[model samples]
Target: MENNQEGILLTSAEQSYLWTTYQADTMAVCVFNHFLQHIKDNEIKSLIVFALQLSEEHANFIREIFIKEKIQIPQGFTESDVNLHAERLFSDVFYLNYIKNMAKGGLVTYGRVLQNVYRKDILSFFSACLSQSIELNSRAIDISLKKGLAIRPPTIPYLEKLEFVHKQSFILEGLGRREALTGTEVTNLFANIQTNYIGTSLATAFSQVCKTKKAQNFFKRGKEIALKHIEVFSSYLKMSSLPVPGTYEQMVTQSKDAPYSDKLMMFHFSLMIYSGVGNYGLSTAETQRSDLVADYTRLNAEILKYSEDGANIMIAEKWLEQPPLAANRRDLAKG
Candidate 1:
């Protein structure tokens, strides 16, 4: 047997976490492959293909590790599990948002894995995955901006000069307190900016895919909520002198005959909500200042509600994962 010291031995909790991540990665690969078949944009397709390959590789790696440790691998979703036809029924806009949201979730997952891992090899692997995820997200963001699938936020000019002068009782400030945003505040603003973009993209995609008056109305309301948040975040970015993210200029669609299915659209939206929650959690933890904390906390709560709504939609659509629930306390006690 390989030495436990040489190969990392995960605790039960760690195993559970790894299992969750593995399942998410597997789902991502399946979603990307479906997107690959329908996507016509070469750059976006290439990025999605690359991301799929990475996710597959990571899944294999985890499986190998679990095998080596004599631990049962979690029964996660596989290529055989996903309904490709159902996914393909969605519009290309929905696919783009799906992939982007998955990539965002990957960023958070890898970051958490990096923090939890202690073994050198495991840490290095997670770190590499984290970097790759970030790159993928950046590329997706770029594609979304170019295709006008995302909305851009405002930005402030970079400081080119700084001067400090002090008198007996007076001081000169280059920018007013209201005009400059602190670094910590800027980070929170950026987090919210990304969240808004994801939310809007999902709403727009859902509206197009569902093609029903009620569904479209639901999506329109979602878009309005995201727009309000975008404005709030943009104000912060403008005050801080930071660049805003790109905005959507045109709607994305696949062939009229192959409009996205409602199930696929809702699944993608659910994924985005989970990603947004993860990002908000990270931002809340990362920001230490009181004002920034308050902002992130409020944002986090709003996202929680959005996530709940998405979950309800998924349940109505029967697209959510059905994990086994414990029967009763007596059953558990007997075990």
Candidate 2:
């Protein structure tokens, strides 16, 4: 246990938060640099500039803490991980959506991390992160709306009257017997579909630009999985005669230049996979429908498998960075 002047040690939760946050911020810095290289839209460029500044600040803050604590700072994504000369791979609209989507993840992450952190400075850092993420999301959404690019979640009919379900069948789904989707289920389905839409396009672009055969195959498989999940999610909406979110594959350009290194792209995919799993877990926990729960569970398993394979690839390439670990008493005994 490390003791500072305050006599408090950094707990597992705090360390984990800081370690993972450092990685994510560094990756963001790399991608933002690439975006800045080719972004022509002044407004979108402004958002990128703000996002890059935040990520750089976060990485530097973590670096100082690690230095003071005598911990090894993570070699997160760097200049070598991005190619500024590569052609633009995505549209201006995607840059906005990417920022908005990533900001949502930041809000979720910072909020969760904030709850588990208690040190005054750590607490303040995460609180600021939450505020910044919210502002980022707000800014991106405002710009998206201005450009008519915001794909707002679908709205269901207003409740005419409150009602209660008296039968267990309300939780069950089957041929000719499934009840209409509830508001929560509708929201989850719509949000997941849109996320898959983004994933589908990302996978496609990665497939086109990934450097190696193994990575290309992995990304192609990811695109297939994302498309299948989108179909599965959209089916539930169709069953109830509701609208589904549209795909964004056209948002990707025809450029095959590898804007990001294979290591960076693989890490980015892992982050997306983890986020998707968390989303599915939340959706499963919140939904009352048995069928939806089963599908979320099954699909999450497939994604986990894909994520594991991605991990193996990263490990093989020496691109996977280990996190801070607790002391091993057995190893200490050997020493």
Candidate 3:
């Protein structure tokens, strides 16, 4: 942690918050601008505009703090990374779904940062961010539901009696048929499926537009992984006689022209892969069924390896930024 005699220095937590927000907001600006150029739905377009404004405001506020602290601001994604005149990469519905997922991520991120932040100003800033994220999440949900675009988890029949676990089979797969999934299990499964759907679409688009063969190969591999995960999850739903959530892969255009720089696209997919792994871990914990837990565990391992490869690519390209770290006592001693 950096500190001064006057106690005006930024703590590690505050530094982390500022850095992450700057990067996220910068990426959001590029993504939102591209969406704005292609979006046709007035309702979805309005929400995107609102979200973009918030992201821009956040970027500006974080930059001001970085300037005050004399910290070098990260040159994240920018107009140079995006082409507003490029052909559409995703449909309008994909834009709405992307924002909805982003809002959920924002709420979770702000809430976690608020817990770690100790500086009064930083705490207050994250508190407000959490509030705004909540509002955006609610609005996105309302719009999605109203327009019949929300991919809700299947609802089961109401239980008539309180039942207790009678056998170990309740948590394990038995020799025979397994019981139907609980509501929490269903929710987790569907959420994972939904994320993979979005990933598949994005990876497909990137595969077609990335400049380098290496980047294109990575995107193509990611698309295959997402499709396999979706199939695995869809099978679970089908076994339960639940309707599998549909994807918007068909909405991607055939244009091979890159709308985003290769670096930006790689970073964006890396973020999605990391987020997916986190979600899978949480989903694994929420499941009591042995088979489903095993599935999540195995899939998480696959993506974890993939994410490591992505990091290596970023490092090779000098695109990966170093986050805040504690002082190196060994170096100080050597000096």
Q: How would you encode candidate 3's per-residue C-alpha lDDT over 1-335 as one tens digit per residue?
A: 22222457888888987898898889989999989988899999999999999999888888877887788998887889999899988888888889888897887678778888877777777887899899888888889999988877788999999998787777868744466888998888898898898898899999999987888888899989999999998899888899888887987889888889998999999889978988898898889998999899999999999898888888988888887788999999997
**Roughly what TM-score does model 2 have, to 2 decimal places?**
0.95
Worst 10 residues of 1 by lDDT: 168-177
Cα lDDT tens digits for candidate 2, 1-335: 22232556678988888999999999999999998988889999999999999999889887887777777889998899999999999988788888988998998888788879987777878888899999999999889899898888778888899988777677765523556888899999998998888888888998899888888899889989999999999999998888888888898999999999998988998899999999999999999888889999999999999999999998888999999888899999997
lDDT accuracy of residue 327 in candidate 3: 91
lDDT of 2: 0.88
lDDT of each: 0.64, 0.88, 0.86
Q: Which ten contiguous residues of candidate 2 have the minimum total lDDT? A: 1-10
TM-score of 3: 0.94
lDDT-wise, the better of 1 and 2 is 2
Higher-lDDT candidate of 1 and 3? 3
Top candidate when judged by lDDT against the true structure: 2
lDDT of 3: 0.86
TM-score of each: 0.66, 0.95, 0.94
**lDDT measured at residue 309 in model 3 versus the true structure, 0 to 100:** 86
Model 1 lDDT, residue 202, Cα: 56
Q: Which number leads on TM-score?
A: 2
